[model samples]
Target: MLSNRYFTNGIDIYFDNVCGSMLDAVLNMTNHGRIAVCGMVSQQRLSQPEGIYNLFNLVIKSITMKGFLQSGYLHLFPMFLEDVVRFYKQGKIIYLEDVNEGLESSPIAFAGLFSGRNLGKQVICVARE
Candidate 1:
């Protein structure tokens, strides 16, 4: 699957999870690039997992690696909300929800979070708050 990515063309940014070959290929590319890390899909057993990207290559290429988390922009929430609402209104940001009916479904919904069974956001239907 990584081979099909064809990162040989060089990309400005790459997002991957624990796919060392993909990261390695991106690093090996002649042009500089950046990678956005969401999760490591390959390292499921390790208590503390690490990415496969080579530090030497990253330094040589002047690539930037960054973590994307909402908390990092807590201070920018107000500005983010303004843009988010505009995007939502324009129908640019579409959300997929897995809604399991019944109060007892909370356990199942929570389990999906860890198992990756939920393709998008997972929600359990209970009494409306």
Candidate 2:
């Protein structure tokens, strides 16, 4: 059982990445909350995704849940890139890259993502451009 202090007032918005127990916990703590379902890394390799016991809370609390895909927003790429470049140039953003030296290391780099072995965005440098 979670402490009352954990959600005494309830959450307004939740950005979900790892779904499963964490999702369940959020569900129980939400009150008319808005949940942005980003990624479900927790259920990626599972044969069957775990069921959420607190799903009924969504109805009870009148929550809003939405899923998004980056590809779906490709039309806004130019705007996104402009903002990112402006931020980067203005020293407002710091980018991190976990780069693998050769094409041979591509598999390892891909696997590292799922295992949390990569520290930053994994990149396989086939040949430096």
Candidate 3:
């Protein structure tokens, strides 16, 4: 779900609609509120077409939106690795992966990612890298 709210400076935020509509959640925001964009559930193909995002609200709010991914910070991989390891060792982190053996299953594994069929990360194990 996507929503818009106005603070001192109007900033709009889009929330994942897994549990409820993000659009409804942000309508009551005050001034100078901040929004962090992580993922989009409105992109899903569901029984109903999701509501359109209010671009006008964003423009009026002067909202600042930002997104981040691991690949974008490849240079900081070492630091990320260390932080992740500590969290993992503390049992504060969990991961899921779908591993397919043999090169023959590579295509299937790749397809899973595009289809969102794989429960977690999809990995293909080839005899050679």
Candidate 4:
């Protein structure tokens, strides 16, 4: 829903996919908001990931913060795929991905992800049938 729009009031469920803007996210979050930390691509390439501060806002605003990995939802893959396909067909979503074909190009693709060179979902395709 936040593709190219603005929030009138404030954010409700903030998904921290980038992991570099916790301070700003917390600042704009409504009371009792929740944060789901999924990806940390911003700090993936760094030798030392940047530390997050101002966590007291979570207490003051009564926010909940949690981290999760994609594998955690492995059981829901089929249902998720069905929904995604239906949404795509209905034109509710636009899928974008950067695929590097061949195992030899995986290094380049992986590097492109951390460097922001890839435009969308980074994928290293080892084979095609």
Candidate 5:
């Protein structure tokens, strides 16, 4: 549960419900970073949400940011898969995951996810595919 993970390694990819962290992530990103805005969880509750002032960082740093949800893009799944598969084959994309073994580890893995301990997409391997 280290808060400084991004601050230390810098954010190559970022997404947050709140814009404040998004700004921080923008600043913390390495060169050629990407930001994918999935949802704004906290802002949904807040009447006055935060605003990001330093968007120029994206331009200066050559960062890319896009906001979208999977459900909204369900129709484009085939296209997405084709592109992703090609990218993967070309080694243009890197995937990261924190995989935990056993069904018993799920609770801990789930907890780590919320606590920010997981480094990437967290998964509990109840069985092999």
Candidate 6:
């Protein structure tokens, strides 16, 4: 898999939004790694989720994992939005979106987010502006 190939020497930092298999795979390959856990979409629908086996590696590798909620940092939204707008106007940022037309395609588009079928951000357009 990508983790086995890319993390041969281990990673310094990892931004983890998808927890489950990917997180389990990364735990084994972390060397003083700092993991910022934002979401756990992988385990959302599971009644019984798989347990991480290599959690002991955290102690061995001195890894740090922290979870955060964006709602808690609502105060920073203006600053964040400003930076995003600046980057977008300066052509420093690229937005890649898989847009599904109409409400009928919303289910497929939303499901694609978890399946990795969408390349970047997935958007469901009910109407054009």
User: On residues 22-118, what C-alpha lDDT tens digit does candidate 5 reach at each position?
Assistant: 4454554677988887766435555676666667788898988888876998999999999999999999876568899999999988766544456
Per-residue lDDT tens digits of candidate 2, residues 75-101? 999999999899999997744588999
User: In model 5, which residue pairs have backbone atoms overlapping below 3 Å?
Assistant: none
Model 3 misplacement above 4 A: 1-79, 127-129
| lDDT values, one for every candidate | 0.64, 0.76, 0.53, 0.71, 0.68, 0.77
Worst lDDT window (10 residues) for model 5?
Answer: 16-25
lDDT of 4 by residue, 1-129 (tens): 232234557667766666654334444577898888888777777888777665787889898989999898999999999999999899977546778899999888877666546644788888898
Q: List where candidate 5 sits over 4 angstroms from the true fold.
A: 1-27, 40-66, 127-129
Candidate 1 C-alpha lDDT tens digits along 1-129: 232354435456666554444456556544467778766544565576545556687788788888786567699999989999999999987555878988898897776665445544678788776
Higher-TM-score candidate among 2 and 3? Answer: 2
TM-scores for every candidate against the unseen true structure: 0.50, 0.54, 0.40, 0.55, 0.57, 0.61
lDDT for each residue of candidate 3 in 1-129, tens digit (9 for 90 to 100): 112222343323433222124443454344444455555444454566556354354456565445555367799989989999999999976545778999999887776554345544578878765
In terms of lDDT, model 1 sits at 0.64
User: For candidate 5, what is the lDDT?
Assistant: 0.68
Candidate 4 achieves a global lDDT of 0.71
Could you tell me how far off, in angstroms, the CA of residue 118 lies in candidate 1 after the best superposition? 0.9
* Residue pairs that clash (backbone atoms under 3 angstroms), model 4: none
- Candidate 5: lDDT of 107? 90
Clashes of each: 0, 0, 6, 0, 0, 0
In candidate 4, residue 112 scores what lDDT?
67
